[model samples]
Target chain A: MSLVEVTGLTKVFRRPVKDPGFRGALRHLVSPRYRDVTAVERVDLRIEPGEAVAYVGPNGAGKSTTVKLLTGIIVPTSGEVRVAGLSPHRDRIANARQVGVLFGQRSQLWWDLPVRESFTLLRDMYGVPDSLYRARMKRFDEVLDLGSILPVVARKLSLGQRMRADLAAALLHGPRIAYLDEPTIGLDIAVRDRVREFLRQLRDEGTTIMLTTHDLGDIEDVCERLVIIDRGRVIYDGSLAAVKDDFARERRIHLQLASPVPLASLSDRLPDAVVVAGDEPGEFTVTVDRFRQTAGAVISAVLPLAEVVELRIDEPAIEDVIRKVYAGELRLA
Target chain B: MMEYEADFWLLVLAGLLQQLVGLAFLGAVFAQVQALHGWTFTEAVLLYGFASFVFGMSPLFFDGLWRTAWLVNQGDLDYALVRPYPVMLQVSGSYVGLQGAGDVVVATCMIGWALSRADISWSPLTVLVGAVLLVSAVTIRVSVLAASCAISFWLQAPHSGFAFAINQLGTLGRYPLTIFGVALRGVLTVVIPFAFTAYFPVSWLLDPGRYWWAAIVTPLVAAYSLILGVRIYHRGVRRYESAGH
Candidate 1:
């Protein structure tokens, strides 16, 4: 059964849409300027139970807007949205009890309070029993390494730590569905991987997860399905690997050297791999088109130049694909 | 089991410390005036203390007013709505003004100083009336702001307009309502009635000889503002569209 369903979900922002200049600003205050910016237009989607789907899009592409609508923070201007067979907007309270949400840019935790206090507050707000709360915290600590940061105040925690705590808070109620918006945004790769690992566990436990992120690694690591939204509409909804194979037809190879090497010289040696920026002379990046050549072919071409202490192949990242989709190069089929 | 005991007590404890600081400031002023304006220093002190108490108590107890604008801006209210608790209670618990403590102690000291210097002591009846009226005054005052921010869900920029309007109303309540003259006072007493929150009740509590109706006005104003504020809030929620989506 589909745990989440939406049909023709449209949201229009009337606050910011205005004619240009000071004259328009003055006129707006008097007549109440309204702009009909269709944030989510005719968005139709369905997610079956226990599905781990990645929802990715460009900036201002209404990814957050869609999450807000799904979580019932804002009422929809038009359309119907249901979570666990409940209208998220109409029965927002009930829907909330069944779903956990985390937005990376902002935290729901109290700034002055310790991380544990935040989790406790959420436990109360969600009406979870103490035994279950303890059990969930124990699981989260094991999965996300939450114990190391639990004693710190929310404002004091690093962005990565705060995001991890937020994830735990969202799940304290044992929600059936989870929504994570940019959960790894602005974090180091190690931190991102830690959060991703926790998410994978949630998916394996049969929890339906709807994740929105610019980090392609998050999708590649946890989600099997991909739902790409562009210009307020879902352009592609299918297997993550298929999306990767389709628009992301390029790969990147990195070469780390034992000795310092000049950029100009490396560029002359490995023309196939563009010297993408790196720290010091030890690292250089080479982007290769899979359509033109393969990873093995690129590796053989670059192996002789650098001692090749470490070599990594970068999959076509979703960030580029999402950017392309927004640029109108990759359209939904 | 579903209680934010830590948040709750911390708010109260913080407010208590803040109120003491305010009281100490006012205490310095009292040593010089002996009396302020007309009444003995204690009566003036009592009025000031009472006002502080209400300010501190309202924010500490009913945090929704101070935080509604912020919550609405961030769409944090959405979190409250999804939870099974009453939306109002959730918002009230979201944040309390840390400065509330300063206001609380000053108010109590003012009232106590006034009682000490009063030529004639406050009768127990007058004390009873003052207590009831003070509680009512806090309710009405907070209700006005809560209603203001609740409408903020629709207003594009509500913070300045809200602060200005509430403070303007405060000018009526903070000083004697009679200072504004009969016509101005009438507008406050009837149209806005923020004047009643402090002035009418204070006059009735301290100068019972001059204002007998003040005793009756306390309960009436509290009941009116609270009911109206909540009603206005519910109406605004219906008009509320979510941020962005």
Candidate 2:
């Protein structure tokens, strides 16, 4: 059976429609107006057990709204959302026991208390057994290095260290599913890698994961399935490789040669491959169809004419693909 | 069911120290003369004990009243609304301030000394009655402050306003409500109801007023404010601007 089954999921928020200024405000005091803001509209998605799916979208693209609906933070306007065969809104306590959620910008840890105290509070709040809590704490220390940071208050930790502790706090309940909204935002590269590694381990242990982030590297390294939304609707849902390749038939290979070369001279050598763009010396951005020429074939062909010191692959970034999806150009892969 | 002895001690000690200063201030004036009220200096000690005990108990058990502003700013109140327990109960138990427990012990010690000099009699049944009324008074004060926090969520005013008002109410709460005229008396009884939280309940148990029902009605009145506070909280959540929303 599927761990999560969401069909025709929709959410609408009624926002106030009052105009600005004192006169408009005075008029609203007597009788207020309202506007309909469709946060998540008609989104159909399904996830089987242990699937690590990434939900991505631009700002105001209904990504966070969809998450609130799924986690039972807000009630949906219409349609059904089920996790582990229960409506999240109807059986929130029972459902909350089975799932864990963490919002990166907002913390679940107590602000004034030490991180270790917050973890102890959660142990009782979630009814975690003493043996299991101890076991999980040891494992978290190994994975996240939580020992040094445990004594520090949450308000004192850097954004990176805080995210690590929050990850451990969320998983101590032994939930079957986890939702992370931008868990790596505003963190250094090393911290981001550790968080991604921790997530990979969680996924390997058969935990269904749902993630939303603007970082393309996070998408590439951690997520298996992809769902893209734009302006309150799902635009594409498929594998990560499929989403990356869906936008173009060819990949761009950028070449960095050792010496400066004339643009016309480089273009003439590889007539089929265009010298589309490049600015630096010893660098040429070449566009070629992978079907027609292999990267090695192009490298062998270009190495003779120019002194090739380094070579690099230039595939379209996940950001560019999402921009197009927001523009209503891309479809399900 | 929840006995927070560690938190309770911290508050009780703090309350005792603050009341000791009040005791000294009154003693300095009375040293020149004899008695200001009907009773001697010892009776004044009993009133101070009663005031500090009620104040410390309310803050120690229901310290989350101070944190409502944090919840409002952070949008954490939404988590409380979806739970099964009473919203006010959840708000009160969410935090436990240790300092307030320290004050409670001081108040208890003063009460013992007051009984030694003051011409007062205490039976088991009367003591039990007074203790019950004191418990009700704590609930009333907590609910009033919580209601103040609840209403400000919609006003978008900084939580500082409600906090100042709570402290002001508790400050005025230290005095006997009957010494004031009809206007302030009515306001304390109807508009804010701080008198019920401290003055009326304690006085009824101490003097055994004909209005003994005030002790019974204290919790009931607080329950009304709690219901209204919850209504305001739920209404605010529907309009709350959550993080990055």
- TM-score to true structure, per model: 0.74, 0.77
Error of 2 at B183 (Å): 5.7
Q: Which lDDT tens digits does candidate 2 get at residues A1-333?
A: 688888888877666777789888898889989888888899999998899999998888888778877877677778899999988776767777888887777677777788998898778877899999999999989889999999998889999899999999888888899888899999999999999989898999999999999887887788888898888988788888776666654668878888888888778777778785477887888888766777887888777777788777876667677767767676654
Query: What tens digits encode model 1's per-residue C-alpha lDDT throughout B84-193?
Result: 66677777766666546545655666667666776544678877887799889888877876787676766634363674476456534555454467787787778777
How far in Å is the alpha carbon of B88 misplaced in model 1?
4.7
> How do the residues A150-238 of candidate 1 rate in per-residue lDDT, one tens digit apiece?
88988888888888888888788878989988889899988888898899989999999999988777888999999988789888899
i-RMS for every candidate (Å) is 3.4, 4.6
DockQ for model 1 equals 0.28
Q: Fraction of true inter-chain Cα contacts (below 8 Å) kept per model?
A: 0.53, 0.08
